[model samples]
Target: MIRGDDGIRAFFAGLARDWRGWRGVRKWDTIEHDLAIKARHTGRKIRLNFTLRPGSDRDYWIVTLEMVIPPDESLDRLARDIGELFGDL
Candidate 1:
């Protein structure tokens, strides 16, 4: 699991680099200390979120990957891919 503030920053930075290469556009929303983006990959609209949570002793983060399943795409496969993509963080 990711621990500490530096790890959190590094994680987001890496995500930015990867998504930027994929033509993702970042957006600022009402949420605090979070990152949101909208992008298209393989012609699919994707939403990515990195949310930060503060705890008693430390801060933590949650990563989410979302996309609409195309008629030709298997929901199970897409779900697994989304899980694996953000699960590491």
Candidate 2:
């Protein structure tokens, strides 16, 4: 599990890096068009928003990732990549 400010920053940075490589076509209905509109834009960077909340038990954390995806990016592919990154959790 990630701890400290540096780790959190690194995690977000990694997500940003991965965002650039997201390509290919997805069904129009599956694409989150509203997310792109809500994305935080600062200079040339498009930042995705997320929240980390405490879980019911002390041993866990709930991470909610809000993505800003292009129309062409596949939701299924993104889900697969996330699964690979976080394993079965």
- TM-scores of the models, in the order given: 0.26, 0.25
Backbone clash pairs for candidate 1 read none
Model 2 regions more than 4 Å off: 1-49, 55-66
Q: Each candidate: what lDDT?
A: 0.41, 0.39
lDDT of 1 by residue, 1-89 (tens): 33224233333344334432355454433233344434343444334443334433334555556644332334335445545555565
Evaluated against the true structure, the overall lDDT of model 2 is: 0.39
